[model samples]
Target: MAADDNENWEDRPLIMPFCGQSCWLVYQTLERALGRSVIIEPGLSWTLVRRQDPNMEHLAKITKCNTMVVLAEKLIEESFDPIVDRHTRNNMIQSVVYNCGSNFPRTNFSRFYTAILENDGRVISAASLRIPSPEIAEIPFIATSEAWRRKGMCRKLLEAIESALGDIGIKRIVIPSSTEMLAKWQIKFGFVNVDYQTNKNIKELNTLMFLKTTRLQKVINPITRKTADLNFLPPSSPRLPPAPPSGQ
Candidate 1:
């Protein structure tokens, strides 16, 4: 399992359904390693609205900003660094939001998951899932607070988002991930390198690597058909099942 944004997660842990004591311990381990206070809560719309102070402008910004079309506006405002950042991972969420929001309008902002925990009334160490296209939700970002680095928080958070996605009838997931860690996760999660590209001068920017969701893919079944050779088949015959042989 992995973590995604929605740190203000509800009173639920996003770990695999069958995850056991060891997994729970991992969460604690991460907390201890980061040495930052963390709480996982659901990213409720009402909660986000209430969290946004009475600054009408900021609310409007959230409402009108093209970037806010998805759920990562808050993260972007918090300032994102693509390099040396494990929690935030790459700016995958930002890139997905920017790309889609740049083309779509703000009112179309649909429901998505972001795992966030309130720290002294300031939301921090967040991650988000973009359902721009339902069948293929994109994990754009999964970041932990600077003080919260080296903790297993990010992975735990992603598991939470995946649970939400499953409940919502989503399947076939995709994540924009770093190339270096790609191999590590591939070994860990069975992901494969489908494609790769790059940009020079960009530090730690993942030019390539995508993590596919096996859980999500299982929800879909492929349609199959059998083809017959025209020359081998009897002319003008319907492709029907053969009749059973006479009983002895």
Candidate 2:
């Protein structure tokens, strides 16, 4: 299908940065572009968390809901969901699209990724990496389907995106979260709360977090090319800046 044709299937206005096709196509594009094979186990099956993988093990053991983490890196291709009826899935997608707004085409510098349930080709979670400059990339709109909560899908999607970004030398990640829970989760994943001054355009509900792979205390200005403390902000300081002009 043409890229334009797939726009309607998206839940939000933001354009996905990778190949404008299925999640498998995006995965393949990342692998080829980064020159590293992307390996994600296929299937929605469950497995005992290995003791060596303490983080997963801890999460698996502590959850009160008893929802086992679906043990897969990527969803299996062309699988079908036995439990979710077609009507329910369509309604869920429609609700998400309605709430998320009109289609916004992606730019060359930005990339998008998603985690899907192999059964029925359902997108369980998604993320975006926007490269405003060579040294910095912002991760926006990390969302998971309501019906697929606590399944470890978001975590896997994040891991895949971060790994790809790191491999390509984009180490700093700017994430604007909409809730305290999300902020705490980002912190747990190594992001630090910058607590920068709030942008007038952003609602009071959101919080901003920044993270760097290296210990360097300085961040270079994307526009000026001058190095400054990581806390620096542009004059506009409009929280996370909106996506660039649609056509660029």
Candidate 3:
């Protein structure tokens, strides 16, 4: 249907950067344009996580892999274009990067990483890493500039993030991405796919993929006590009546 027709479709589907059409201008515009009403439906995204990959096997072979790390705050401005440019040309990467940037909500910008490799103490490649959320720290991004893809640069960077996270007591991670190539790499790295995709989407334009790398231990306890937990109650306070009905 036409873009403007989205408003009337109360059944309008949830799109990315937004949970529902209630907050999406484009969806509203489309509904208006097509004269189709919208109906709010149930579809929301889920948070996922996993531990970072250490890449011990590859790091052992490299002689001069100096790990100089850059955290999320450091690489916030740099786009994911370099790697995207390699897979898809610079133009497509630019377009996709721009689209992805503009579409995602500002709040989802928390976890991110970029790494630089040093060989014999010299910089080797442009690297970028990211963790989507604090709760689901399972998967991270390790992107090496096109020139450094096959030279074990990515593996080194992965090891760096892996070590960093482990030092901080983060044992699991979850990556929210999906592609045939990525799937293959994940398999090689021993990432077990949880295979759970959320109801969240960017309208009909895109679908998010969730791959679980680490499963955290969940503790379940039975709740036999029914009294409302006083833990949520306020401190004891005596309330006085309204001044004897205003001095009646």
| TM-score list, all predictions | 0.39, 0.37, 0.35
Residue-by-residue lDDT tens digits, candidate 2, 96-195: 2122222432212113222222223334554433443333445543556666767776666555555444444444556654454554555556555443
Q: Give all candidates' CA lDDT scores.
A: 0.36, 0.35, 0.31
Off by over 4 Å in 1: 1-113, 117-122, 188-190, 194-248
Over 64-157, each residue of candidate 1 has an lDDT whose tens digit, in order, gives 3332233344564454543322443435444443432222233222233344433454444465544433234555555655665565545455
Which RMSD values do the candidates have, in order? 21.0, 16.8, 19.9
Superior by TM-score: candidate 2 or candidate 3: 2
RMSD of 2: 16.8
The positional error of residue 153 in candidate 1, measured at the CA in angstroms, is 0.7
Which stretches of model 2 miss by more than 4 angstroms?
A: 1-37, 44-120, 195-248
lDDT of 2 at 208: 20
Which of the numbered candidates is closest to the native, going by highest lDDT?
1
- Ranked by lDDT, top first: 1, 2, 3
Instruction: Return the TM-score for candidate 2, rounded to 2 decimals.
Output: 0.37
Clashing pairs in 2: 17-111, 17-112, 80-120
Winner of 1 and 2 under TM-score:
1
Q: What's the residue-level lDDT of 121 in candidate 2?
A: 38
